[model samples]
Target: MRKLVIAISMLAFTGAAASADPIADRQALMKERGKLVGTLSKVVKGEQAFDAAAVLDALKGLEANAEKFDTEALFPVGSEQGRDTTAAPKIWEDKAGFNAAEDKFLADVKAAVAAPPADVDALKGPFGTIAKDCGACHQTYRIKKG
Candidate 1:
């Protein structure tokens, strides 16, 4: 009975938390996304001090943000109404592939961020590889809303 009560309380709490605040949520996500891209760009261009520790930290943040983008709450059903959302409908259809892409993106970014080039000046190869995964997913899943 105690366990059941705890579970019920947890579920209620989670349900309350799941209520969407679309604007704030999107803003927060976009902020993190921009930070991730900015950090990656700096490392790639040798503009920032390429500390492996710092890179790993940024990568972890990026991965967590990426995972959050996978949640249904963010892309709620029937949310395709005039919100500038770039998510294509095919994402739901190709759920497995979309999920796999997200997973691969996280893993690739993690590895690349964790094992960044010792010689920061010549980071073209590693950075380009990581960027490729991002582009690949965008090409398939993200809509070009021009």
Candidate 2:
């Protein structure tokens, strides 16, 4: 019983500590976001023939990713300093502006999901919009590591 208690406690502690690392969490979130975009980009570029269902699936995944991106929890103060984070100091300096950018990301993703594209041509505009949104945010809020 004592051993079981100790193991459980250790697991709980480690889980909490891991989850509390906002920098790592945010990085993972951003990576997932990028991957979803890549998937959609392939369809947009005609690298993959567009299947309406698959396109919708990727867009839905994007919506889910955006929903999970909580700036407050993911970008906590001081989280930009470690784990090779690229977050710009302006994120903290202009919290409102940063949040507005995040909000726009989520809202645009949701719009894409709500009105999914029916063809590659249709996907192009939404994909372009998403790419632009990402680039704009990176330009304003991310420091290029390279």
Candidate 3:
């Protein structure tokens, strides 16, 4: 029950307001996504003890962030032109492909949440998958920024 409650509130915790400036909103969410991934990375690296509950919470956070990704709202036309945005022009040109990438990422996240690892060693495979999923999206839809 408590985990479910945490998962529910994960949206608010990760949300950066999808109201006005979507570029900012998506950027903020991505930053939070990094933090969530970092938490799991630590566990996977053996830097943190494996606590199933903690892993589940982090997984839930990923799930929340993935589920909240409103592509249409966040990637609106002209949004790709924002100076502060790292989104690639292909995001606009290849909207369907971008949407497909996002769908795969969200599905992978939900799958991790559904069958969360019981230990740190068990987490490596899923963690690798999640990392690859993010990389795939960025490769196609994001522009590198210094």
Candidate 4:
């Protein structure tokens, strides 16, 4: 029993010390973005009350993630192979275009943060634009999982 406990502790420590893979990092970032966007959507659709502080926090999270998307190092070559990544090959094939798309997303998120919507009705336009941009990128750069 003592030997088994020691082995389990070693395993847990190793797992904790392991470095994160880039694809995994990106996937986690995207998941965070999705959660933030989902929360904002609820606010925009009248399902939740429009709180300026919450809206700002969500938008700021999106903006920070958008900027991270611009980092060339984040999408290192061959990073997509081992993981269950949704990233498309074209992201590396046409790196410039991918970067451009990321730049546009960053700009859009920054703009939204700068001039946040006052109410649910007012949020519709800007939120729609952000959603459109996300869809465009996903359509072009993300592969649908089976």
Q: Count the backbone clashes (under 3 Å) in each candidate.
A: 0, 0, 0, 0
Stretches > 4 Å off in candidate 2: 1-18
Candidate 4 lDDT by residue in tens digits, 1-146:
32443344345333433645677567656776787789889998789999876787777778766765534666888876775788999898988988888888888889988998787777788789889888998999999999
Point out the higher-scoring one by lDDT: 1 or 2: 2
The order by descending lDDT is 3, 2, 4, 1
What lDDT, from 0 to 1, does candidate 4 have?
0.75
Report the lDDT tens digits of candidate 1 across residue range 1-146: 32443344345334544656543464456555666667868977768877765655555656556656644665555664446677778776787887788788777766765665565554556567667877887898778867
Segments in model 1 whose C-alpha atoms lie over 4 Å from true places: 1-19, 22-27, 113-117, 121-126
Error of 4 at 31 (Å): 0.8
Ordered by TM-score, highest first, the candidates read: 3, 2, 4, 1
As for TM-score, the candidate ahead, 1 or 2, is: 2
The C-alpha stretches of model 4 lying farther than 4 A from their native spots are 1-20
How well does model 1 score by local distance difference test? Answer: 0.63
Compare the candidates by TM-score and give the number of the best one: 3
Cα deviation at 4, candidate 2, in Å, is 34
Tell me how far the alpha carbon of residue 54 in candidate 1 is from the true structure, in angstroms, after superposition.
3.2
The 10-residue segment with the lowest total lDDT in model 3: 5-14
lDDT values for all models:
0.63, 0.78, 0.82, 0.75
* lDDT tens readout by residue for model 2, 1-146: 32443344345434544877888677766776787789888887778899887778777766766776778888888787876889999999999998888888888888887888988898888888888899999999999877
lDDT of 4 at 40: 86
Task: Quote the positional error of residue 126 for candidate 4 in Å.
Answer: 1.0
